[model samples]
Target: MTDHNTAEWWRQAAVYQIYPRSFADANGDGIGDIPGIVSRADYLAELGIDAVWLSPFYPSALADGGYDVADYRDVDPRLGTLEDFDRMVAALHARGIRVVVDIVPNHTSDQHAWFQEALAAGRGSAARDRYIFREGTGPDGSLPPSDWVSTFGGAAWERVADGQWYFHHFAVEQPDLNWSNPEVREDFLTTLRFWSDRGVDGFRIDVAHMLTKDFPDPLPSRAELDAMPQDGAHPLLDRDDVHEVYAEWRAVFNSYDPPRTAVAEAWVRTPERRAKYASAESLGQAFNFDLLEADFDAEAFRHIIADNLAQAAATGSSTTWVLSNHDVTRHATRYGLPPLNGRAEKQGAAWVRAGGPEDQLDRETGLRRARAATMLLLGLPGSTYLYQGEELGLHEVADIAADERQDPAFFRGGEYDGLGRDGCRVPLPWSASGESFGFGAGRSHLPQPAWFADAAVEVQAADPSSTLSLYRRALGLRRRLQTDEGLEWVDTGRSDVLRFRRPNGWEVITNFGTSEHEIGEEANRIVLGELRDGRLPGENTVWLALRA
Candidate 1:
């Protein structure tokens, strides 16, 4: 059993991110719930992950796929109640898997009591003060208060019957709260305690960088906002003010018996800016998305690895690495595309929109690179997060019908115009063939493709060389290599290859070239995954344990 006193167990942990609605469904409800997660505790334990990070399951309008939380203290009925949540946590704990839940503190659903009251209380009321409400500019107050645009699309401000405009970073239904208000800060603290008291291990903070807004005199236009220098202060997003909020949250976490922890989903521009969210006084870790955004190039990866490790060390924080999440396309599909060629920033929500021809996507090639990437990621010396079904080599469901697409981005910018995140959130496949591929007893909330049968857990489990087995083997072996030490580069004089030596004499090497690379006779290596013909094939990674 993991000792709660360790307090730093998250430093080198492997966390599985379970998008509740897509993970598993125990009942015939078509939606994954707490009971389903409870039943899968054994599967997770066998997968050898250290913890499970559950995406938002709180009461929500699902305007942003549960990011529009209605109640921070209660569970959504579709997912389950607080009782089911407690039971799920207990079941996971019995199997030695920690539970880390998603916390969306930046906004609340329009259906939330606070938001509802704010809408009825009219402008200048105390209820309205809890949220970012302003009078629209212009003659008739018809125009929005600012030119700021939503992260999903369209205008960020929405007008109410009271002639006031409210700010929402994502959807009109998700109103951003005023963090500057003492009541808002205190209420979040109460919410944090509610989960901590319930024995939750940690939290993955959503919109962690966008919590603080500077309210620029004339809010920047969409283009200007996107082009603003992340190094300097901005009107909204990653402002210095956000750190103050995390610092206080850290204090609350420290007050707990073992001191709960947090990882921020802060997508800042530079490694330096990302480090600020993971400093000793703030959240314990901030996901370094630079690695996820890296192109399939050795030089690009090497630079990101070195920069991220350096930044984490400087801040006394653990480096968090993740390849894919609910919001982005799976790396398998991503790697299948042409290399970004230093245009990694283009890999945003609209990646699929700018994608090449369907024939250009080499799924087989992408799967090979994904296996190699997993080895490289697992071999690193820090925390790693794996999205659900990624172990089964699940690619993004590209053909999600317009009617089935649920992401707010897809609707905010007109149907099909904005390729939403629904593709990545397809229900996972557990069986080779079933009504919903064993995702649930009924129709899945999001339809699974017929191709999912090939990647089903049942099919992959029987195949020793499948990606599921690769993840299981890698994770089972990772426990022995856990450490806070950073990685060191092993120069092989090849620009297309990346070789890094861990402190334990374990070397991780990946060849990005189109040719096979020789494994020196002097080196004794364990074939990690997807190695071709006993040699390190192009886009393959292997781990070497140098013998004395």
Candidate 2:
């Protein structure tokens, strides 16, 4: 457990992300709820994470997988109630684990009371002014207001029956809020205070870079956007004005006794731009996703690490490292598959939809590389964010039937583009023999593949060589080995291997190539991987203690 009194505890914390719906189900409803999280509090504590970052458990109509929040202050009835949320927070705190909840500030569900009122209040009404509403382009106003497109696909604007078009960066069910509206800004401040008062340790701001937009009278077409310089400010993303919103949010966060912390889910292009969200006046941390998008190559990982370190130093903030999340394919599966040829964002959706050819994936090699990659991730300086089930080496459930797909991206022409994220959101397998593999008494909302039986928590728990055991040992060792805020690169004289030394005299060496590498260090203990004939095996990571 981390010392809460320590300043910026999150800087060194190991945060675990729990996707609420698939984490665990306590009520046998097939959907994970707050009580389910409470039930797993001991498990989380045993996993040795400092905090659990819960994805949106708020009231929703299942639009955009709860990103389209209908209400910010309460839990969905299907998931749990306010009392249950309180209980969940208390339970984790009792185990010395912090609670970080997700906050979707960019947009709100159309089902929200405010949006409902906006629809009824007619065009140009005060309620309508709370969201982005514009007139159509054509004479009869048949076309949309702009040529902008949603991140999920299709036109960003949705025309209402009243002949006015409202913008949604995502699905039509999620309407973008107008940050220029004082009411919209103040209401979000209230929402922050509501959760802060309930004792949440921090927040993970959803689409943090997208709160403010700078749409011209006639928005540039998609082709023009493609031709624009990479450094140019996006019309709807990472605009300069978004920082002002975070400034206000920072004030609210600072008003609390412990001063709640936040991490921005900003997807800006450069490390410098991303660091702005982690400046002193903004959110204290921002996810460095370059690692998630990189190949398993050693040079790629080295470059990303150096860049992230420089960015963090510039902002005086810690880097947040994550390999897999609910939005992408599990690293285990990705490592097993062939190179994506620059289609990393798709996560092999097209290949998976085609039944995942055996020749395309080397499962054993993938798991080995995934383990090595995690070792590299944990050994790095700064905070580490672990997605749920990565500890058990879970793979993407790619063969989910098309008829059962629920991700809004799948329905909005994203399937053809191989953009659906459902494969990574399958429920976890706890037991090997249960009807739903211990997810719940009922069937899971997304179908679980049969291979999950081999990866069940029970089975992994009993196997010492399993990925679960590796994670436990690695996490336990990390708590002791992580003594400095930076690392010194150790030259291995080989391009295929990476070696870095922590200030405390602990060295992390990983062999990324097929050839075995010699262990040149005289260490007191081998913390993680093993050595064959005093040589580190290919695709293996070893941690060594070189000092007292």
Candidate 3:
């Protein structure tokens, strides 16, 4: 069992992210609920994760996939009651797992009571002061307030009948809250206390760097903003004012008995700015997305790891490693496809839509590389966040019909114009045969392709060579091997090979070249991968313990 009293347990923990809507469905209602999560408590414990970061389950319209929260203190009736949420917390805690719920402070749903009041109270009222509302530009206020564009696409300003426009960084249904308002700031504190009181161990702040904005009288166009130096404070994102908000939040977290923690989903451009969010005075940790955006090349991975470690060291915070999440294509599928061109930011969603070209898509190679990457990630020296279904080596389901699509980004004309994140958000397959592949008794909200049956948990659980089995063994061993908090790079003499040794004599070597590499040193035993004739094959990783 884990010692909850241990200082900074998260620094060396393995956290699994659960998209609540797709994890499991206990009521056979085609949607996963809190009750469903309760049912999978044992499964999560068996996965050997120290904590689970649950995506938002608050009342929402699901505009932008629940980032648009309608209520901060209640559960969505469709999902379950507050009692059910309490039960889920208890179930996970009973199994020695911590709970981290998502907190969306950047924006709120249009359906929220505050937004509704803002609309009815009209322009210049105290209600309207809670959110950013401004007079539109152009004749008779017919245009948007400024040239700012939504990250999801389209204009960032949405007009109401009162001739005023409200700002939104995402979809029209989500209005950006004015953090400068005392009421707005105080309400979020209330929200933090409410969840902390419910026994939630931590929070994952969505768009953590975007809570504050400094819009100039004449906002710059998207092109102008893109060309400007991102290292400095910006008009809409990563401004200096944002850190003060988290500083207040940190105080609330410290009030708890164990001192609740938080991780920020900040996408700041530079490493220096990113470290500020993860500083001891702010959120405890911030996600390092450099690894997620890297190519499957040894040199690229080396640089990313080195940079992230340096940033973590500077801030006195733990580094975070993540390969896949709900917002992007699964790494297994990405490794199978060719390198992307101008649309690289989309992560090959368009390539998947083009049928994954039979000649170019190498499934076997992709899975092999994915396994190697997992070994490298687990062997690292800090927190690791694993997306659900990745343990089963699940790839993206690119063939969902258009009519069945959700994801608000799909309708927006940006990187997600032709395809959105639904492909990665499909329900997990538990059984080899069922209408929803044992996800539930009824049909899933999204369609599960026929190929899911082959990768179902039931099929992989019994196969020793299967990805699921590998994860089980790797996680079990990770607990014992993660004794050191730092690693030294070993000189493999090959640019395509990577070797890093932990202080405890455990080493990890990965070959990204086209040919096999010799194992030049003696080891006590191979803990993860096998060696063919004392050599490691390309696109493979092996864990070893050096002899004393």
C-alpha lDDT of all candidate models, in order: 0.84, 0.86, 0.87
What lDDT, from 0 to 1, does candidate 3 have?
A: 0.87
**Clashes by residue pair, model 3:** none
Order the numbered candidates by lDDT, best leading: 3, 2, 1
lDDT of 2 by residue, 430-478 (tens): 9997878998888988899889999998899899999988898888888
The CA-based lDDT of model 1 is what?
0.84
List candidate 1 stretches off by more than 4 Å.
1-5, 216-232, 342-349, 352-357, 414-417, 530-534, 546-548
For candidate 2, the clash count comes to 0
* 2 versus 3: better lDDT goes to: 3
Could you tell which candidate, 1 or 2, scores higher by lDDT?
2
**In model 3, where is the ten-residue run with the lowest total lDDT?**
349-358
Q: What is candidate 3's lDDT per residue for 1-548, written digit by digit as tens?
A: 23334747888889999998898999999998899899889888888888999999999998877788999999988899999999999999899899999999988999999999999999889999999999988979999877878877888899998899999988999999999999999999999999999999999999898898777777787788777765547777788788899999999999988889899999898888898899989998999987666668998999999989988999999899998998877888778877664556554455543225446777888888888999899999889999999999998787887899888877785545556789889999999999999999989999999999999988998899999998888888888778757889999989999999989888899998879999955534678888888889999999997544
Query: Which segments of model 3 are wrong by more than 4 Å?
Result: 1-5, 340-359, 520-524, 546-548
Each model's TM-score? 0.95, 0.95, 0.96
* TM-score of candidate 2 against the unseen true structure: 0.95
